[model samples]
Target: MRMNVKLSPEMERFIQGKVASGMYGSATEVIGDAIRRMQAEDERLQAWHVAVRVGEEELDRGEGLPYTPAALDEITEEAIRGMHGNAPACRDVLP
Candidate 1:
Protein backbone atom coordinates (compact mmCIF):
# COMPACT_ATOMS: atom_id res chain seq x y z
CA MET A 1 0.00 0.00 0.00
CA ARG A 2 1.12 3.56 -0.78
CA MET A 3 0.03 6.63 1.13
CA ASN A 4 1.01 10.29 1.50
CA VAL A 5 0.99 12.10 4.80
CA LYS A 6 2.58 15.12 6.44
CA LEU A 7 4.37 15.04 9.77
CA SER A 8 6.03 17.58 12.02
CA PRO A 9 9.78 18.02 11.44
CA GLU A 10 10.55 16.35 14.76
CA MET A 11 8.34 13.35 14.00
CA GLU A 12 9.83 12.97 10.52
CA ARG A 13 13.31 13.04 11.96
CA PHE A 14 12.32 10.51 14.61
CA ILE A 15 11.03 8.02 12.04
CA GLN A 16 14.03 8.54 9.80
CA GLY A 17 16.37 8.07 12.75
CA LYS A 18 14.73 4.76 13.65
CA VAL A 19 15.32 3.46 10.15
CA ALA A 20 18.85 4.85 10.00
CA SER A 21 19.64 3.13 13.30
CA GLY A 22 18.84 -0.25 11.63
CA MET A 23 16.21 -0.97 14.27
CA TYR A 24 13.26 -0.32 11.94
CA GLY A 25 13.60 -1.29 8.25
CA SER A 26 11.63 1.72 7.03
CA ALA A 27 9.35 4.57 7.94
CA THR A 28 6.38 2.27 7.36
CA GLU A 29 7.63 -0.06 10.09
CA VAL A 30 7.94 2.79 12.57
CA ILE A 31 4.47 4.09 11.69
CA GLY A 32 3.04 0.56 11.92
CA ASP A 33 4.59 0.06 15.38
CA ALA A 34 3.29 3.45 16.55
CA ILE A 35 -0.23 2.60 15.36
CA ARG A 36 -0.11 -0.81 17.02
CA ARG A 37 0.94 0.76 20.34
CA MET A 38 -1.84 3.36 20.04
CA GLN A 39 -4.38 0.58 19.36
CA ALA A 40 -3.20 -1.41 22.40
CA GLU A 41 -3.50 1.70 24.58
CA ASP A 42 -7.01 2.34 23.25
CA GLU A 43 -8.00 -1.26 24.05
CA ARG A 44 -6.65 -0.94 27.61
CA LEU A 45 -8.53 2.33 28.12
CA GLN A 46 -11.76 0.80 26.78
CA ALA A 47 -11.43 -2.12 29.20
CA TRP A 48 -10.83 0.30 32.07
CA HIS A 49 -13.90 2.34 31.08
CA VAL A 50 -16.06 -0.79 31.02
CA ALA A 51 -14.78 -1.85 34.44
CA VAL A 52 -15.51 1.62 35.87
CA ARG A 53 -19.04 1.56 34.47
CA VAL A 54 -19.69 -1.86 35.97
CA GLY A 55 -18.38 -0.68 39.35
CA GLU A 56 -20.61 2.40 39.16
CA GLU A 57 -23.64 0.23 38.47
CA GLU A 58 -22.76 -1.98 41.42
CA LEU A 59 -22.41 1.07 43.65
CA ASP A 60 -25.81 2.32 42.50
CA ARG A 61 -27.31 -0.99 43.68
CA GLY A 62 -25.39 -0.76 47.03
CA GLU A 63 -23.50 -4.00 46.36
CA GLY A 64 -20.31 -2.86 48.03
CA LEU A 65 -19.13 -3.30 51.59
CA PRO A 66 -19.11 -0.51 54.14
CA TYR A 67 -15.99 -0.16 56.26
CA THR A 68 -15.32 2.50 58.86
CA PRO A 69 -11.97 4.25 59.15
CA ALA A 70 -11.38 2.72 62.57
CA ALA A 71 -12.20 -0.75 61.28
CA LEU A 72 -9.81 -0.29 58.36
CA ASP A 73 -7.07 0.86 60.74
CA GLU A 74 -7.63 -2.23 62.85
CA ILE A 75 -7.44 -4.44 59.78
CA THR A 76 -4.21 -2.80 58.66
CA GLU A 77 -2.74 -3.22 62.12
CA GLU A 78 -3.74 -6.85 62.20
CA ALA A 79 -2.17 -7.40 58.79
CA ILE A 80 1.08 -5.88 60.03
CA ARG A 81 0.98 -8.11 63.08
CA GLY A 82 0.37 -11.15 60.89
CA MET A 83 3.34 -10.22 58.72
CA HIS A 84 5.45 -10.19 61.90
CA GLY A 85 3.98 -13.58 63.04
CA ASN A 86 2.42 -11.94 66.10
CA ALA A 87 -1.26 -12.40 65.10
CA PRO A 88 -3.55 -14.38 62.80
CA ALA A 89 -4.40 -13.10 59.35
CA CYS A 90 -7.28 -10.67 58.91
CA ARG A 91 -9.20 -13.31 56.96
CA ASP A 92 -9.05 -15.57 60.05
CA VAL A 93 -10.67 -12.77 62.02
CA LEU A 94 -13.46 -12.38 59.45
CA PRO A 95 -16.79 -14.22 59.75
Candidate 2:
Protein backbone atom coordinates (compact mmCIF):
# COMPACT_ATOMS: atom_id res chain seq x y z
CA MET A 1 0.00 0.00 0.00
CA ARG A 2 1.64 3.22 -1.16
CA MET A 3 0.78 6.15 1.06
CA ASN A 4 2.25 9.58 1.66
CA VAL A 5 2.90 10.84 5.18
CA LYS A 6 5.23 13.11 7.03
CA LEU A 7 7.61 11.90 9.70
CA SER A 8 9.55 13.80 12.35
CA PRO A 9 13.23 14.24 11.49
CA GLU A 10 14.26 11.99 14.39
CA MET A 11 11.88 9.24 13.30
CA GLU A 12 13.06 9.53 9.69
CA ARG A 13 16.67 9.20 10.83
CA PHE A 14 15.81 6.22 12.98
CA ILE A 15 14.09 4.44 10.10
CA GLN A 16 17.02 5.17 7.78
CA GLY A 17 19.41 3.89 10.42
CA LYS A 18 17.45 0.68 10.73
CA VAL A 19 17.66 0.18 6.99
CA ALA A 20 21.35 1.04 6.98
CA SER A 21 21.96 -1.49 9.75
CA GLY A 22 20.32 -4.21 7.61
CA MET A 23 17.48 -4.62 10.09
CA TYR A 24 14.88 -3.72 7.49
CA GLY A 25 14.88 -3.65 3.69
CA SER A 26 13.27 -0.23 3.30
CA ALA A 27 11.52 2.63 5.03
CA THR A 28 8.16 1.06 4.19
CA GLU A 29 9.13 -2.17 5.91
CA VAL A 30 10.19 -0.29 9.03
CA ILE A 31 6.98 1.69 8.99
CA GLY A 32 4.95 -1.48 8.53
CA ASP A 33 6.57 -3.11 11.58
CA ALA A 34 5.84 -0.02 13.66
CA ILE A 35 2.22 0.07 12.49
CA ARG A 36 1.76 -3.58 13.40
CA ARG A 37 3.20 -2.97 16.89
CA MET A 38 0.96 0.07 17.38
CA GLN A 39 -2.10 -1.94 16.39
CA ALA A 40 -1.22 -4.67 18.88
CA GLU A 41 -0.74 -2.12 21.63
CA ASP A 42 -4.09 -0.53 20.80
CA GLU A 43 -5.82 -3.88 21.15
CA ARG A 44 -4.10 -4.53 24.47
CA LEU A 45 -5.10 -1.12 25.81
CA GLN A 46 -8.70 -1.67 24.74
CA ALA A 47 -8.88 -4.92 26.66
CA TRP A 48 -7.25 -3.36 29.70
CA HIS A 49 -9.70 -0.46 29.61
CA VAL A 50 -12.64 -2.83 29.55
CA ALA A 51 -11.29 -4.74 32.53
CA VAL A 52 -10.73 -1.54 34.49
CA ARG A 53 -14.18 -0.18 33.65
CA VAL A 54 -15.88 -3.39 34.63
CA GLY A 55 -13.97 -3.55 37.89
CA GLU A 56 -14.98 -0.01 38.75
CA GLU A 57 -18.61 -0.77 37.99
CA GLU A 58 -18.44 -3.77 40.26
CA LEU A 59 -17.01 -1.61 43.03
CA ASP A 60 -19.79 0.93 42.54
CA ARG A 61 -22.31 -1.89 42.83
CA GLY A 62 -20.74 -2.76 46.17
CA GLU A 63 -19.28 -6.05 45.06
CA GLY A 64 -15.90 -7.59 45.91
CA LEU A 65 -14.04 -8.68 49.02
CA PRO A 66 -12.23 -6.51 51.50
CA TYR A 67 -8.59 -5.85 50.82
CA THR A 68 -6.22 -8.42 52.19
CA PRO A 69 -2.60 -9.22 51.49
CA ALA A 70 -3.30 -12.90 50.84
CA ALA A 71 -6.25 -12.19 48.58
CA LEU A 72 -4.22 -9.71 46.57
CA ASP A 73 -1.40 -12.22 46.32
CA GLU A 74 -3.74 -14.88 44.97
CA ILE A 75 -5.16 -12.56 42.33
CA THR A 76 -1.72 -11.37 41.32
CA GLU A 77 -0.34 -14.88 41.13
CA GLU A 78 -3.17 -16.12 38.94
CA ALA A 79 -2.83 -13.19 36.56
CA ILE A 80 0.90 -13.76 36.06
CA ARG A 81 0.90 -17.55 36.02
CA GLY A 82 1.61 -17.61 32.29
CA MET A 83 3.65 -14.43 32.24
CA HIS A 84 6.80 -15.63 33.96
CA GLY A 85 7.56 -18.01 36.83
CA ASN A 86 4.96 -19.09 39.37
CA ALA A 87 4.53 -15.40 40.13
CA PRO A 88 7.27 -13.11 38.87
CA ALA A 89 6.55 -9.39 38.80
CA CYS A 90 7.49 -7.53 35.59
CA ARG A 91 10.39 -5.89 37.38
CA ASP A 92 11.74 -9.37 38.03
CA VAL A 93 12.09 -9.85 34.27
CA LEU A 94 14.37 -6.78 33.89
CA PRO A 95 16.80 -7.36 36.74
Candidate 3:
Protein backbone atom coordinates (compact mmCIF):
# COMPACT_ATOMS: atom_id res chain seq x y z
CA MET A 1 0.00 0.00 0.00
CA ARG A 2 1.30 3.44 -0.88
CA MET A 3 0.43 6.15 1.58
CA ASN A 4 1.81 9.63 2.09
CA VAL A 5 2.98 10.55 5.55
CA LYS A 6 3.88 14.03 6.77
CA LEU A 7 6.85 14.17 9.12
CA SER A 8 8.51 17.04 10.98
CA PRO A 9 12.01 18.21 9.96
CA GLU A 10 13.61 16.22 12.81
CA MET A 11 11.71 13.04 11.95
CA GLU A 12 12.60 13.41 8.27
CA ARG A 13 16.28 13.74 9.18
CA PHE A 14 16.04 10.71 11.49
CA ILE A 15 14.60 8.53 8.74
CA GLN A 16 17.18 9.81 6.28
CA GLY A 17 19.94 9.03 8.78
CA LYS A 18 18.71 5.44 9.14
CA VAL A 19 18.92 4.91 5.38
CA ALA A 20 22.29 6.66 5.07
CA SER A 21 23.70 4.53 7.90
CA GLY A 22 22.75 1.38 5.89
CA MET A 23 20.59 0.20 8.78
CA TYR A 24 17.45 0.51 6.63
CA GLY A 25 17.03 0.21 2.86
CA SER A 26 14.46 3.00 2.70
CA ALA A 27 12.14 5.18 4.75
CA THR A 28 9.38 2.60 4.36
CA GLU A 29 11.48 -0.13 5.97
CA VAL A 30 12.38 2.10 8.89
CA ILE A 31 8.73 3.08 9.48
CA GLY A 32 7.61 -0.54 9.15
CA ASP A 33 10.14 -1.67 11.77
CA ALA A 34 9.03 1.07 14.17
CA ILE A 35 5.34 0.15 13.73
CA ARG A 36 6.09 -3.54 14.32
CA ARG A 37 7.92 -2.69 17.54
CA MET A 38 4.97 -0.51 18.67
CA GLN A 39 2.54 -3.34 17.99
CA ALA A 40 4.65 -5.77 20.06
CA GLU A 41 4.75 -3.28 22.94
CA ASP A 42 0.95 -2.87 22.79
CA GLU A 43 0.49 -6.64 22.97
CA ARG A 44 2.77 -6.84 26.04
CA LEU A 45 0.79 -4.06 27.75
CA GLN A 46 -2.47 -5.88 27.04
CA ALA A 47 -1.11 -9.09 28.56
CA TRP A 48 -0.08 -7.17 31.69
CA HIS A 49 -3.57 -5.69 31.96
CA VAL A 50 -5.12 -9.16 31.77
CA ALA A 51 -2.74 -10.44 34.44
CA VAL A 52 -3.66 -7.53 36.75
CA ARG A 53 -7.35 -8.23 36.26
CA VAL A 54 -6.89 -11.92 37.10
CA GLY A 55 -4.92 -11.00 40.23
CA GLU A 56 -7.69 -8.61 41.31
CA GLU A 57 -10.32 -11.32 40.81
CA GLU A 58 -8.27 -13.77 42.84
CA LEU A 59 -7.94 -11.25 45.67
CA ASP A 60 -11.71 -10.65 45.54
CA ARG A 61 -12.23 -14.42 46.01
CA GLY A 62 -9.99 -14.34 49.11
CA GLU A 63 -7.23 -16.36 47.46
CA GLY A 64 -4.60 -13.77 48.35
CA LEU A 65 -1.76 -14.52 50.73
CA PRO A 66 -0.47 -12.18 53.39
CA TYR A 67 2.80 -10.43 52.58
CA THR A 68 5.64 -11.48 54.89
CA PRO A 69 9.40 -11.12 54.89
CA ALA A 70 9.82 -14.90 55.06
CA ALA A 71 7.56 -15.39 52.06
CA LEU A 72 9.55 -12.79 50.11
CA ASP A 73 12.82 -14.48 51.00
CA GLU A 74 11.51 -17.88 49.99
CA ILE A 75 10.23 -16.58 46.70
CA THR A 76 13.50 -14.80 45.98
CA GLU A 77 15.45 -17.94 46.76
CA GLU A 78 13.21 -20.04 44.56
CA ALA A 79 13.63 -17.58 41.69
CA ILE A 80 17.41 -17.63 42.07
CA ARG A 81 17.46 -21.42 42.20
CA GLY A 82 15.28 -21.62 39.12
CA MET A 83 17.64 -19.27 37.30
CA HIS A 84 20.51 -21.63 38.26
CA GLY A 85 18.61 -24.59 36.71
CA ASN A 86 17.83 -26.17 40.11
CA ALA A 87 14.45 -27.64 40.94
CA PRO A 88 12.27 -25.67 43.30
CA ALA A 89 12.60 -26.73 46.92
CA CYS A 90 8.91 -26.39 47.72
CA ARG A 91 6.26 -26.77 45.03
CA ASP A 92 3.48 -25.77 47.39
CA VAL A 93 4.60 -23.30 50.03
CA LEU A 94 1.03 -22.22 50.78
CA PRO A 95 -1.51 -24.53 52.38
Candidate 4:
Protein backbone atom coordinates (compact mmCIF):
# COMPACT_ATOMS: atom_id res chain seq x y z
CA MET A 1 0.00 0.00 0.00
CA ARG A 2 1.26 3.48 -0.85
CA MET A 3 0.47 6.23 1.63
CA ASN A 4 1.84 9.72 2.12
CA VAL A 5 3.16 10.68 5.55
CA LYS A 6 4.07 14.16 6.74
CA LEU A 7 7.09 14.35 9.04
CA SER A 8 8.75 17.18 10.91
CA PRO A 9 12.14 18.41 9.71
CA GLU A 10 13.93 16.46 12.44
CA MET A 11 12.04 13.24 11.76
CA GLU A 12 12.62 13.63 8.04
CA ARG A 13 16.35 14.00 8.67
CA PHE A 14 16.31 10.99 10.96
CA ILE A 15 14.68 8.80 8.34
CA GLN A 16 17.03 10.11 5.66
CA GLY A 17 19.97 9.32 7.91
CA LYS A 18 18.79 5.76 8.36
CA VAL A 19 18.55 5.24 4.62
CA ALA A 20 21.89 6.96 3.93
CA SER A 21 23.60 4.86 6.59
CA GLY A 22 22.41 1.73 4.77
CA MET A 23 20.47 0.61 7.85
CA TYR A 24 17.22 0.91 5.88
CA GLY A 25 16.46 0.75 2.20
CA SER A 26 13.89 3.57 2.39
CA ALA A 27 11.69 5.61 4.69
CA THR A 28 8.94 3.02 4.36
CA GLU A 29 11.24 0.30 5.63
CA VAL A 30 12.28 2.43 8.60
CA ILE A 31 8.67 3.30 9.44
CA GLY A 32 7.63 -0.32 9.05
CA ASP A 33 10.38 -1.51 11.40
CA ALA A 34 9.40 1.10 14.00
CA ILE A 35 5.72 0.12 13.79
CA ARG A 36 6.64 -3.55 14.24
CA ARG A 37 8.65 -2.72 17.37
CA MET A 38 5.73 -0.68 18.76
CA GLN A 39 3.37 -3.61 18.14
CA ALA A 40 5.69 -6.00 19.98
CA GLU A 41 5.93 -3.60 22.92
CA ASP A 42 2.14 -3.31 23.04
CA GLU A 43 1.82 -7.09 23.16
CA ARG A 44 4.35 -7.30 25.98
CA LEU A 45 2.42 -4.67 27.99
CA GLN A 46 -0.83 -6.60 27.45
CA ALA A 47 0.77 -9.80 28.74
CA TRP A 48 2.00 -7.95 31.84
CA HIS A 49 -1.52 -6.62 32.47
CA VAL A 50 -2.92 -10.14 32.30
CA ALA A 51 -0.27 -11.43 34.69
CA VAL A 52 -1.05 -8.63 37.12
CA ARG A 53 -4.75 -9.51 37.04
CA VAL A 54 -3.95 -13.17 37.77
CA GLY A 55 -1.73 -12.16 40.68
CA GLU A 56 -4.47 -9.93 42.07
CA GLU A 57 -6.94 -12.80 41.90
CA GLU A 58 -4.54 -15.09 43.71
CA LEU A 59 -4.08 -12.48 46.46
CA ASP A 60 -7.84 -12.13 46.83
CA ARG A 61 -8.07 -15.93 47.26
CA GLY A 62 -5.42 -15.89 50.04
CA GLU A 63 -3.01 -17.80 47.84
CA GLY A 64 -0.24 -15.22 47.81
CA LEU A 65 2.95 -15.54 49.82
CA PRO A 66 4.10 -13.01 52.39
CA TYR A 67 6.37 -10.27 51.02
CA THR A 68 9.23 -10.64 53.46
CA PRO A 69 12.88 -9.75 53.07
CA ALA A 70 13.73 -13.42 53.01
CA ALA A 71 11.30 -13.97 50.18
CA LEU A 72 12.89 -11.12 48.25
CA ASP A 73 16.34 -12.60 48.79
CA GLU A 74 15.17 -15.99 47.61
CA ILE A 75 13.57 -14.51 44.51
CA THR A 76 16.72 -12.54 43.75
CA GLU A 77 18.83 -15.64 44.14
CA GLU A 78 16.53 -17.60 41.89
CA ALA A 79 16.74 -14.91 39.23
CA ILE A 80 20.52 -14.84 39.40
CA ARG A 81 20.69 -18.61 39.20
CA GLY A 82 18.37 -18.48 36.23
CA MET A 83 20.75 -16.07 34.44
CA HIS A 84 23.47 -18.67 34.98
CA GLY A 85 21.23 -21.52 33.79
CA ASN A 86 21.56 -23.26 37.20
CA ALA A 87 18.10 -22.72 38.68
CA PRO A 88 14.94 -24.78 38.36
CA ALA A 89 12.43 -23.68 35.75
CA CYS A 90 10.23 -20.67 36.63
CA ARG A 91 7.12 -22.86 36.98
CA ASP A 92 8.88 -24.87 39.68
CA VAL A 93 8.98 -21.79 41.92
CA LEU A 94 5.21 -21.21 41.76
CA PRO A 95 2.84 -22.36 44.51
Evaluate candidate 1 by giving its C-alpha RMSD to the native, one decimal: 8.7
- lDDT by residue (1-95, candidate 2, tens digit) is 66799989999999999999999999989989999999977877777788789999999999968899999999788767757666555532332
Order the candidate numbers by TM-score, best to worst: 4, 3, 2, 1
C-alpha lDDT of all candidate models, in order: 0.85, 0.83, 0.86, 0.88
Ordered by lDDT, highest first, the candidates read 4, 3, 1, 2
User: If both were scored by lDDT, which would come out higher, candidate 2 or candidate 3?
Assistant: 3
lDDT of 2 at 61: 95
Model 2, CA-based lDDT: 0.83
Q: Could you tell me every candidate's TM-score relative to the true structure? A: 0.66, 0.69, 0.81, 0.86
Deviating ranges (above 4 Å) for candidate 4: 86-95
Candidate 1 is scored at a TM of: 0.66
Error of 4 at 33 (Å): 0.2
Model 1, residue 26: displacement in angstroms?
A: 0.8
> Quick one: best TM-score, which candidate?
4
Q: What does candidate 4's lDDT look like per residue over 1-95, in tens digits? A: 77888899999999999999999999989999999999977877777788899999999999999999999999999788787896566742343
| Model 2 bad stretches (over 4 Å) | 75-95
Q: Which stretches of candidate 1 lie over 4 Å from their true place?
A: 67-95
